[model samples]
Target: MASAAITLAAEAPKLSSANTGFMLIASALVLIMTPGLAFFYGGMVRVKSTLNMLMMSFISMGIVTILWVLYGFSLAFGTNNSLIGWDSDWFGLRKIGLTELWPGYTIPIFVFMIFQMMFAIITPALISGALADRVKFSAWALFVALWLTVVYVPIAHWVWGADGWAFKLGVIDFAGGTAVHINAGAGALGVILVIGKRVGFKKDPMRPHSLPLVMLGAGLLWFGWFGFNAGSWLGNDDGVGALMFVNTQVATAAAMLAWLAYEKIRHGAFTTLGAASGAVAGLVAITPSGGAVSPIGAIAVGAIAGVACAAAVGLKYKFGFDDSLDVVGVHMVGGIIGSLLIGFFATGKGQSTATGVFYGDHSFTQLWKQCAGVGAVLAYSLIASAVLAFLLDKTIGMRVTEDEEISGIDQAEHAETAYDFSGAGGGVVGTAVSALAGAESKKVDA
Candidate 1:
């Protein structure tokens, strides 16, 4: 997410209690999305892989937090005029004062760092959805550490840093359309190319173990997104934050309805999975465009993203790639849809002065700028992530053994089950009892 305009120069900005309190809340909201992501992903995998899926996302929080404190913040927002940022003062978050405002914003430097850190934490976690059910937990953790350093930090600086090239070129990103969603989505595609598909790709149904959990996670994401989108403006000093807050709701609701409509027409039913996925797709789309478009424009963006992602999710089956939970389909495709549409939908009056292709005088320059931003991130993440995954796969191995996967990755990897069946009928060990109970727990992932 980009910060609100920084007008305060050498005359240091004073802290606003309201903005600080609001930002802290926003930071907390963004942090919760990781666990929300865990539940969302956890419920989508088969019974055997649920715990492993949750752990994949949860581990990112632990890994990225430490990295962010140490040097992730410095590299990502260090205010250097280059592709990467570096600040000696921000090293280990030392040499900065408690009351020191972030450049021109009224919030504390820690508040801004923590908010951005949540984005860092969640970006890598988003890739875990594609790696579900088949990866080694240790290898996956290692990839998160490496990928954050190699891919996320530089791109974050490129897009959001005050001195970064994309920011200088005037590529508009209200939140994280390019930096977070596209980065993770591309990384997901790259990693999956190396790890290959789940054990049974087209043969098994491989449905979700818990739709209720998916719905719960989706709801939590929706609630937290108000802060995620609104807080990007950095303050309620102007009504832009309020506009973003409403756009988030409007776009998400529209996307859900549009997706249900598409599902019913294409598949003849409105499934819970479609609703959950559709909501997330809208959130991804608006993340970049919300600050630049109107409420009506947000509806268009959301509806288009909903239908596009709904259609995109089915592409893996036709193309033969095993995106286990459609991370590429939803996030990658949805992010592209949102980021590019800014060229067409921007009103010239929102966050910045840039005009869209559809506005009066019809400037197509922003569209080209958006392409530059999107293409750079997509190419860098795809290549960098693929290299990282290849190194890990060749050395320590990325996937589990076929025997371990078939038996259950939970026991093979984490040594525990997501849902215990031992007490189902005096014991869930027998084939008949296990099969009956497991049958009741089954649902589809796509």
Candidate 2:
């Protein structure tokens, strides 16, 4: 009996191959989301600015990856203090061995690093949508580098880090509601205020050039989000990952339908753009709460986010802010809804142990905590991003010249065009028509 007891105690220390494989695949899935975001945002812009939109997202993948490898991972995941981490021993991953697991988790420390790296890459990419078609490429690149270091690194430490104040206060951000979506959303709003409106703003029509591409991008985002939401569990020991997976799907579907339904009632036309936007809204709302809410709860969250975000998008026009691609409306508003709803809908059975008011916890404590997380991140991102944009604007300038604005940004900035209007000099038909015209002119002259 004594020997059997000792063996059972030792078994828990062994690495889990199954969990490792799942996380490896999950990391790959999440990595693809950045390009998917590229396509999604790329298709939403006018054709003249398409490539710039795509590059903005793709560049974040490169920039954040290097930053994460150097010290970002350490600052985010290291244990040091309540507000932000300060351990440099794991810098460049020198201290962590490949064979060693992450603390008590089944996966290697490297696997966890790459998985989190994907999240860090996509967060700044999300902000690109709001600043499309206006800012200089160099300034934008610099902003990405600066924003990630000042705003993202610390907020991520606060929300997801081991000793983060939010984490210690019982706030439940299962994935990245406060850290990623809210942070990016508020950051976008701040920069938009500093940069001012796009030249056309509401005066000219800036319709999406390709609906098909938008749909394709949205499809990819939906597919990859499974890994993003479910894989946050870090392991599959208790089947909670499966629950998160189902919740993600159900919520997305519900939100898409809700958006379409609202469009039909208000606009009299159900648009493909509306559908794609609705799906993303649902995904954003469920991201933080998927592990805590039931499928029914997910449906409610999706429906609410779909309607709220759909309505919120129009606020740019009403309130007069140039959120070029609805990032403020969809991501910021949806993230807030998801984070706060946890106070009302949390079941306290899956990933988080805290129950909501509806679940019979009978207190507003969780709601207050959620508010703190959302408020702090939003306020900090807004002020910090504004200062960064203002400084860059005053020093190096942010916008292109007026002539560049009238001409397409592709030609003005990159010296290339997404579409070439120049045709072949002349085809066989053109040659025949020219010869006949010359014969007629000669006959008339004679």
Candidate 3:
């Protein structure tokens, strides 16, 4: 009996180590999706603000990385509170040093923390795309900092934290259907309402400068998404994780085909933008249900999401609210579609959990639960985002001067240009003059 027990104990450690290693790799894969987002948004904008839009996402990598290490992690995942997390002994990486805390897996708690950190960083950056080319850089930077602290941290705690109310309520968000997509989409609407439309939103053509760039961005996003969905499982289990991976790919492809077909029927030509947008719409929709639904269910979800998001994009024009980049239409609508559809598509085998409406367990209860969850997130995000935007607009001001906006923020704020072909270029000349004046002022002070 003693010899058998010793063998079992030895095997257990190996299994645990394998699980930890898988989680770490999956998390790293998710981190790469942020830069994919940067390229996607960058390609959608005009050349003048291409670099600015990309910078916004890159900056999050820096800001959120630091904040997560400090207290953001504590506020988000520390406790099971409804409102927010209290600073317990676990605050500021205290519990991280204790190896025993990483239960059920071999990897360190620190690895888990960093993996989640990437998601926290990228969500706000996605919202920034909706208000491109108008807001002051300093203000945008400050807004995300404050928003992450007050808004994101609390919501993440409510949804994914250890003792979160949403978790207790059994709300299913395998990835971030509500926490990331709906939250960012609602926040985009709030800020755009306060800042007003770009200078010539309706009047100017504002065509995308490069379709190829958009395609490149889309490819990256799709590639990185495997990590996003499968990584959520945080284990090497072939059952759930493998299902999620296949669902993600199928849905994306289905959405792409649907979008292109719709565009061809409606418009004269099948544009690349339609294909990329459709794929992303499907990806967003599948995120919430990837782990819960079957492959066939994923196809249905993607097809509906693609069509719905395509139609929803036009609402901005009809309603006269400037979403700028269609963040509300794609992310918000797709998220809702996935969240609700999962109710009808969920299934369970012999040892699995609950099944959905279509699996012979036809009932409205699951659908109703999904609706309630969607409504709660929409209401909370809309109100909180509006309040935050209003306060920021009243205090520091949300937009740049009209003249500064027309000139482009790169020149007005940073005093540099994104591209400079001329040797000792115009930007260099301008910088030299400004430096000379600053030196003169310093000499006077001395």
Predicted structure 2, TM vs. truth? 0.93
Residue 52 lDDT in model 2?
A: 87
TM-score per candidate, in order?
A: 0.94, 0.93, 0.89
Model 2 stretches with alpha carbons more than 4 Å out: 1-12, 423-446
The candidate, 1 or 2, that scores higher on TM-score is 1
Q: How many residue pairs clash in each candidate at the backbone level? A: 3, 0, 2
Candidate number achieving the greatest lDDT relative to the actual structure: 1
- Shift in Å, residue 222, candidate 2: 0.3
Under the 3 Å rule for N, CA and C atoms, how many clashes does model 3 have?
2
Q: Which candidate do you rate higher for TM-score, 2 or 3? A: 2
Put down candidate 3 lDDT per residue, 1-446, tens digits, no spaces.
Answer: 99999998876633356767777777777777788888888888876677787888888888888888788988888764676775565566775564543445565677778778888888888788788878777778878888888778887887777677776666678888888888788878877877788888888777776778788888888988887888777775557888899999999888888878877887867888999999999999999888888889889999989888988988988988888778999988888988888778877641136567887657666677777777777778777777788888889987888877666656666677554433344587767866765674465345
State which candidate has the highest TM-score: 1
Candidate 1 lDDT over residue span 286-365, tens digit each: 99999889999999999999999999999999999999999999999989999999999998888987889888526589
Error of 2 at 108 (Å): 1.0
State which candidate, 1 or 2, has the greater lDDT.
1
**lDDT of each residue in 1-446, candidate 2, tens digit only:** 99999998787655689998999999998999899999999899987788888889988998999989998988888899987786677798888876778877888988999999999999999999998888888888888988988989899999988899999888899899999999999999999999999987899889998889999999999999999999999988898899899999999999999999999999999999999999999999999999999999999999999999999999999999999999999999999999999998899887878888899878788888999999999999999999999999999998887667656677677887665433323788667666765674465345
Where does candidate 2 have its weakest 10-residue lDDT segment?
417-426
